[model samples]
Target: MQTEVIIVGGSFAGLSAALMLARARRDVLVIDAGKPRNRFASHSHGVLGMDGIAGSDLLKTARQQLLDYPSVRWLSGEAVEAAVGADGVQVSLADGTLATARKLLLATGISDQLPDIPGLAERWGSTVLHCPYCHGYEVGGGAIGVLGGVEGAAAKAALLADWGTITFFSQGLPITDDEAASLQQRGVQIETTPVVAVQGEQPQWLELVLADGRHSAQRALFAPALQAMATPLVEQLGCRLVDSPLGVLIDVDAQKQTSVPGVYAAGDASVIGNITLASAEGVRAGVGIHHALVAEDSRPRPTAG
Candidate 1:
């Protein structure tokens, strides 16, 4: 079947973009496999005007809002492959169906790679979190532990110091004497030994076990929690990637159009942006796609006999 645009991933980003296109009377189809990075997160914070809303509930509301427009179609499945073709772009779904559209927006989000620790996965969004702006307030004024997987964790620990008593466990980072002294001046305790595991009576209260067999009790834990975005669909269509501290990043202009023509990306697939920012990016992409389609239709064609 043919559509004006195909949006891959139906979370905050894809849905927001589709809403704009549908409102403009464009045929849009959104495909999602139901795997969102924030599914474990019960409530999402730090989203302007949307603080403390359940992540899944926000998705449902966005989907409902998008559905109010008849020009939009939501497909609850995966868009496995995407490629540019003579028909503009083609996407194949998991259910063995083919879809063609004049434009494509890739919004597949990323996955957080947690440390190799037992029980941490179960408590990821509950107690073990990455973003301070998102979950810091809940654990404020409590005993906190920051696990440094990537560099620059010390600075993050300092930013979080205002909210709690900060203890940074390097997991094994060799630091200069000056660095240790700086952390000391900043009132941040530094631990360089390896961490055996994190334990606690409940998911909210956690304790870190040292390799030397020592244990430290704590109420909250933070980690860099670096992620690898799922941007294969965009990469498949020849989108140029740029490097960032986050991970493999896509270089796009202000309008959310990728370096490649007729292709756009939003959400975590472009750069590591938050849910609200991703939604905004999607809206920009929708506008760009709409204008591109209008331009195509505006060009004068050969008159038929």
Candidate 2:
């Protein structure tokens, strides 16, 4: 099928973009793989008017809002490949379907790679988190532990001190004398033992069992160096990538347009992974696409002389 715009992901970013285009009377289609980065997170914070709302619920509301527009369509499958050619942007689905669109929006979010500690993955999003602003207030004023052995761990631990009493787990990561003194001055306890496992009941408490047969109880564990998994669909389309302190992200212009013309990206794929920011970028991309379409349609035609 063909559409004026095709959004690759249907979460916050893609849906927001689609809503804008659909409101402008454009035929938009959104294809989602059903794997939002925050799927494991029960509730999402920091989004105005939707604070503490369940992450899945937010997507459901967005989907329902899109259903109100007849010009918009959704596909419940993965977009395996995408290419731009004379016909336009062609996207192939895993279910043997092909979709073409004049403009394409890639909002496919990134995947976070956690540490190799036992029981950590299972408790991710609930007890173990990355963003202090998102989950900090909920677990605030308690004993929080920062897992070491990764870059920027010390700084993160120091920053988190305001939220609670911080315990920096070195986890076999070397700590210099000066660094130790600074952390000690800030009253952040430094544990040099390795963390063998992370076991806990989420929203209540967590225990980090150390290799020395000791365990530390904390309200939450923060990991700063979680790696982000690249999106194959975006790579297949040959989009330019930029390496930031967060991770490798899709390069975009002020209007969220990527390196390739007629192709745009937003959300966690282009910027830091946050629902509010992603939704805002999606709206910008939508407006940019609308203006581009209007300009193209209104271009002057050569007179027959």
**What CA RMSD would you report for each candidate?**
1.8, 2.0
Write down the lDDT of every candidate, Cα atoms only. 0.82, 0.87
lDDT of 1 by residue, 1-305 (tens): 78889998898888888988998999998988998878988899988888999999989988888888888888888887889877698999979989999998887877777888776776788778888887889886778888875667777777778778889888787766766777777788888877778777666578888889998887788876666766467657778888766567677898888887788888887767678788888888888888889999999999999
What shift in Å separates residue 197 of candidate 1 from its native position after superposition? Answer: 1.5
Worst 10 residues of 1 by lDDT: 226-235
Off by over 4 Å in 1: 176-182
Per-residue lDDT tens digits of candidate 2, residues 1-305?
99999999998999999999999999999999899988988899999998999989999988998979999988999888899987679999999999999989998988787788898888888888898989999986779999988766887788888889999998787888777877888889988888899887876889999998998999999875444544587778888989867678889998888898889998888897589998998999899889988988899988998
Candidate 1: global Cα-lDDT?
Answer: 0.82
Q: After superposition, how far is residue 274 of candidate 1 from its true place, in Å?
A: 1.8
Q: At residue 55, what lDDT does model 1 achieve?
A: 90
Which parts of model 2 are misplaced by more than 4 Å? 174-182, 225-230, 302-305
Candidate 2, residue 249: how far the Cα is off, in Å: 0.4
